[model samples]
Target: MRCLKMLVIAAVLMFGLTSCGVTNHMISNYNVSQTQLVLSKDNFRVIGDVEGRARATYVFGIGGLSRKAVRENAIADMYRNARLTGAQAVNNITTTVKVRSYPFVMEYEFIASGQIIEFTGE
Candidate 1:
């Protein structure tokens, strides 16, 4: 009986701590400027930094919508924001979304940057 009670407590604790929102650190690492372009020299290109973020209906625990919908919304927002900000090009994009604690759901941040590469043919 004691062992059963202990197991139940552990399960509850685990459930309480589990999250499915997102984090800023993960979003900061994604690249979205590729689609966004700016006028550079004579040609238009994506430049500058790209970032992403998610807005959850619930701070934690995937309360409002389906996981797929939430993810799509977040990515769309990032793209929209990045494009609006005037980026030349975004590359090497990554994201991480997860819930933090209970009743404190949060969305991770997105980040991306554009790099100019030069080729010299002599």
Candidate 2:
């Protein structure tokens, strides 16, 4: 039946899309750098915070994934990427993930360049 065929195609498409994972590559590169720093650091701490960016947000297909899953993935990636750059936490740090959609598939980008800040405790 036509309905059955459509269902099969939809299932395949969803599976392929979800398997693609999060679209936070800039963050991924950062993670690489952060990891490198961690290897050389005498002390390390993990910080979490959120901020907004001027650029249009990015949105990837949710598929069956929850928003929490997506955000967490991005945050973890941000931490890993920051480590690659040799930037250890001076105090605390925050990175923002912006989600926006276009005509085609949604995009999920890390708007962390200017949004990140080094925390200093008094």
Candidate 3:
């Protein structure tokens, strides 16, 4: 009976830790800036490459993890990083998702990358 109780407690603790989704520290440390720019013209010149990543976890499909949320977060992170470098736009954006599963827990990571650009207006 004691062994069974211990097992139950351990399982609950693991679930609690894994269900918290992404951490605030991870999101806050990206140092993304809030700036808007138009990325639809050839006048923009490439400054450099930038990337963002976010993670979500699911346990027996109980967690409210969604691909849309992961994707949005990744893009937001990318934009923030770009803006910090004084970039006026981002282009050639690409997104990728990776999945890892272990018995009851499944984790997904979304990554976004793009080239930072500035409008030359030639």
Candidate 4:
């Protein structure tokens, strides 16, 4: 009985000191700037992958822009690094948000990634 009590106290201390985090993820389809452009298996070839990340901190749930804006900022950052010139497009865009909580502070990290493809002559 004494050993059991000690174990319970240890467990409680461990849990109390541990911090928990939450994550939200989402994936979007093709988001090319061109609307009339048609992409097929034979029309495009995978060139490489592009990724971008953005982070913001909140205290007492007050700070930074809205969630949608943050996501857009991440995607915009990805585009800046994509270096698209011509006949290039990015698809399979995915966005993931991770929120880490500590005391009265929370940090949110957003990551956006996609596949960069270049059109191939038919």
Give TM per candidate: 0.40, 0.30, 0.61, 0.76
Clashing pairs in 4: none
Cα displacement (angstroms), candidate 4, residue 20, comes to: 1.5
Name the regions of candidate 2 deviating beyond 4 angstroms.
1-64, 84-90, 103-105, 112-122
How many clashes in each structure? 31, 21, 0, 0
Predicted candidate 3 versus true structure: per-residue lDDT over 1-122, tens digit per residue: 99999999999888766532442222322323343455565656668999998888888876845877887798888877876444366766777777766657878888888777777756
Q: Please give the distance, in angstroms, between residue 93's alpha carbon in candidate 2 and its true position after superposition.
A: 2.5
Q: Report the candidate with higher TM-score, 1 versus 3.
A: 3
lDDT of 2 by residue, 1-122 (tens): 99999999999887766623344423333333243233354444445344333222333543434554555555555444554333434122334555555444554544444223332232
What is the C-alpha lDDT profile of model 4 across 41-93, one tens digit per residue? 47777899999888888889999887777778888999888998888887778
TM-score of 3: 0.61
**C-alpha lDDT of candidate 3 relative to the true structure:** 0.70
Q: Rate the local accuracy (lDDT) of all candidates.
A: 0.49, 0.44, 0.70, 0.82
Worst 10 residues of 1 by lDDT: 113-122
Tens-digit per-residue lDDT, 1-122, candidate 1? 99999999999899877865434434344332344323345444335555555544555454666655665565666556665432233444555554444445544333322233222221
- RMSD over all Cα atoms, model 2: 11.4
Q: Evaluated with lDDT, which candidate comes out highest?
A: 4
Off by over 4 Å in 1: 1-46, 57-62, 84-89, 103-122
CA RMSD per model (angstroms)? 8.2, 11.4, 9.5, 4.0
- Candidate 4 lands at a TM-score of 0.76
